[model samples]
Target: MTEHAPTTYLLAGGGTAGHVNPLLAVADALRAREPEASVLVLGTKEGLEARLVPERGYELLIVDKVPFPRRPNAAAARFPLVWRRAVAQVRRHIRDRDVDVVVGFGGYASAPAYVAARREGIPYVVHEANARPGLANVLGARRAARVGVTFAGTPLRGGEVVGMPLRREIVELDRAALRDEAATTFGLDASRPVLLVFGGSLGARRLNDTLAESWPAIVGAGWQILHAAGERNELVDSAHPDYRIVPYLDRMDLAFALADAVVARSGAATVSELTALGIPAVYVPYAVGNGEQALNAASAVAAGAARLIPDAEFTPDRVRGEVVPLLADPETLGALRAAAEASAPAARAGTAAVVAQIDEALGRSAR
Candidate 1:
């Protein structure tokens, strides 16, 4: 029998969960498809990938964090030398590891990885997780062998809507099957519908404050609350039996399983997961960045799969008037859930679609 050389894949991205999580999802898919294939991660020492990539058991390749200079300054003066060094580092990794292709999820490391892969004549793929593309993705898209976007209207060169690659737990979760256990895990009544609220890992002060002032109204409306306040949050948990508050959600699958509806930030992953799971939600777009959060939730809102409230407008009064009434109305919630399910087909295919892109890129390389 003849022996075949194992293919090597270099996935580059990391800074936040938005980038790292998707990169990990594709990596997992690649490994599952070809156990003997080499799966490597390129990331900066300062980014979240420093911890997470290693924790996920993938080999982490280090790259210098070089921010694109917005203005002519000292860092800008030194940008060329630094950028050249970063690209050279990635090129060397590609050559030494015999990398067949590169897949980037768009972050600091991706910018240079894209350049390196291009210089080395190896195919590279780009995955943009936001409705508004980032600088790295914007540049990479111009030459990427294939470009994937999480939302339909994201303007990127050759971009196709492939949805967001999600965590295995989120992808495989069966909310109805897990509801009773999830209810027990959160100490809530399985017989009652639960409202889940969160603001990502750090928690959102806006959500915490609004809930603090308006939770009584929610509880009074016959809904249970499971709020994952950020770890830095100091909002004291009220001792109300129906209202449960935690610093962070280590078990998001359980939280999703218990949630009949959600009130949370519209991060790409959050929006993707909620819609993918068919959970109706009210999105409070974080009032920072390039207003991408609002854009992220737009499709869902348009489809009646979710509702949007600006961060500045997510006040206690708004929650009392709008959110409370929505919770009290089961018919509307059911419709929202159905809309979410209807909008989920594309999202559910994200992992497979990204992996297929990778496979096609590899096939082209072989040819």
Candidate 2:
């Protein structure tokens, strides 16, 4: 009789689709390489990962971790308790389920699991999706066997830079079909160019505020708007019949297909997806975290796939300057679109490397 080795992966992180999606990408890669591999996701119950992860068919394990408390006031006193609870959850999962490599995507949500993996002498790796390491990734870095960085310029100084991990759905979208579907579904007239605006999940308040205020000016210019506003965004209404406001967009393939241009935050995954689809975008990287958002948008802008708008001037003048010109010309739009497409992932072959790493790590652990 032949004996086969067992494989188990514990993916940890949550708080946003951005964090969870990359882990999903890695998981997809892992599964493709080893069809028999068992994968489980560890995240907070209230986060999108708990629902999105399992809904996407991965085993979902809810942990006690919360998003890292950024502001000093309210969550400061409560963090230790959260961390302690999270540690307990990690210990319980690792012991009962027999985790192999506990891969962490960036977020405070992954900290306890990473720490637990370290104490248990289990193989662990950290995958950071941003140019600057987030608090969670940074904490896990010291103990991680080999950190994974998506952006080439990540400041970790130690981890291997493997580039961004993108979902298979996004990477393999049928753009033309999406465009036609989006046009018909959203009542967009294909004759006029579509301007896509969205804020992932929590929505962009400042962006929502400015767009709502500038609605007359935008619509007056004869361009169509397909806006995906966040659930909590209170800035605008569906007052104008031409305006479409949904908290979340179900068909981003359709949304991106409908877009002649995109106005969005330059998150690593967003840029990666945009590049993957070869979509031209006007990037407004949020002005926070030592300008990490600005950094995320930089390569795309340099590659001519996108245009960056400084956060301060992201208002009327700059938006008008950047948005109006592209609205009219097919030649410029075509060039940027081609450039974005050209800059997209070559084969999305990061999966094989990841699976090899996991296999090697587990192999050594068994010794």
Candidate 3:
């Protein structure tokens, strides 16, 4: 009997944490399962992947960020030349690395990877992390051997709802076990229910403003607040010790453990993590994009796992009227927590599902 060679995987994505995080989760899963497999990451030097991929001990293959043209401008006219060059770069890397399959998380690097992989007669898979698909994944989905979506109702050909692949730390986290430690870290009473408020890494101006103004109300409701107010936020109030305001929390797992509920923007990762952990949330969708943030929070809201507050309606008045009452109501919070757990997809299994798709694609190619 002959020993089959180890499979080589090339994951293409980047430009944002949404793309990078899922890609890394899947890569970590693959590496953990098959220690000898060659895992390569394709991204532009300017993206977070340039630093992150190498730091995670994966081979980094640089690609040009050749964006597709939208309007008929001079840049649009020159797109064909640049796009072809990007595809060529990917093809060269594919050939040199002997890559068996390509996996794409939608980003600037993914379009070229899709084209090159298709042209090279190599199998590829696509994972779209939002309810609304990006242009790169939209084009790539046509010929992809398999496609996965993090949210339901994503309109992609052959798309399957596989949930978002989360980091190992998040996947294996035990909130109950860590509650005491988390409370200690935040300098809060573990016995009291805590509310966590954050808006991405840099923080949301609206969230900070509203929460700062409503801090007294939140504390008076007998809920401790762990607020990540961003590094640049100017809201200062040292008087309220129960309302802990930190610029950032390096250990988010600890924060999550201490949170009975959360109020924040409905970004893909944030929504996924909150639901996966069975924590109820009041999502203030960032009033940007093609309403994708609101769309991302739809399933949770529909299932009674979360509540949606439009950016315009999220204010101190709203927090005092709606949020404070909700925080005070344990029955409602319990129901929301239950719904969140039931609505959440099997997050830890997401990587396995994508890997299964890759295996099926490989099997077809072998035949």
Q: Which candidate's lDDT is highest?
A: 1
**Model 2, span 1-367: residue lDDT tens:** 3345767889888888778888888888777756787888888878888678877889888787566777786687888887778888888899899887898887756888888898878988888888878888887888777777766778774677666677777767887767766788887787777788886767787678767766556676777888888888775556775667777787777888788788898888887778777789988788766778778877888888888876677786656666766766678878888888787664244444455555555654311
**Candidate 3: C-alpha lDDT:** 0.90
TM-scores of the candidates are: 0.97, 0.85, 0.96
In candidate 2, position 330 carries an lDDT of 74
Badly placed stretches (over 4 Å) of model 2 are 1-4, 66-85, 213-222, 234-243, 288-290, 347-353, 363-367
Better of 1 and 2 by lDDT: 1
Scored against the true structure, residue 338 in model 3 reaches a CA lDDT of 92
Query: Which regions of candidate 1 deviate over 4 angstroms?
Result: 1-5, 364-367
lDDT, model 2: 0.77
Clashes of 3: 0
Report the lDDT of model 3 for residue 75: 93
lDDT, candidate 1, at 78 = 100
Ranking by TM-score: 1, 3, 2
Q: Rate the local accuracy (lDDT) of all candidates.
A: 0.94, 0.77, 0.90
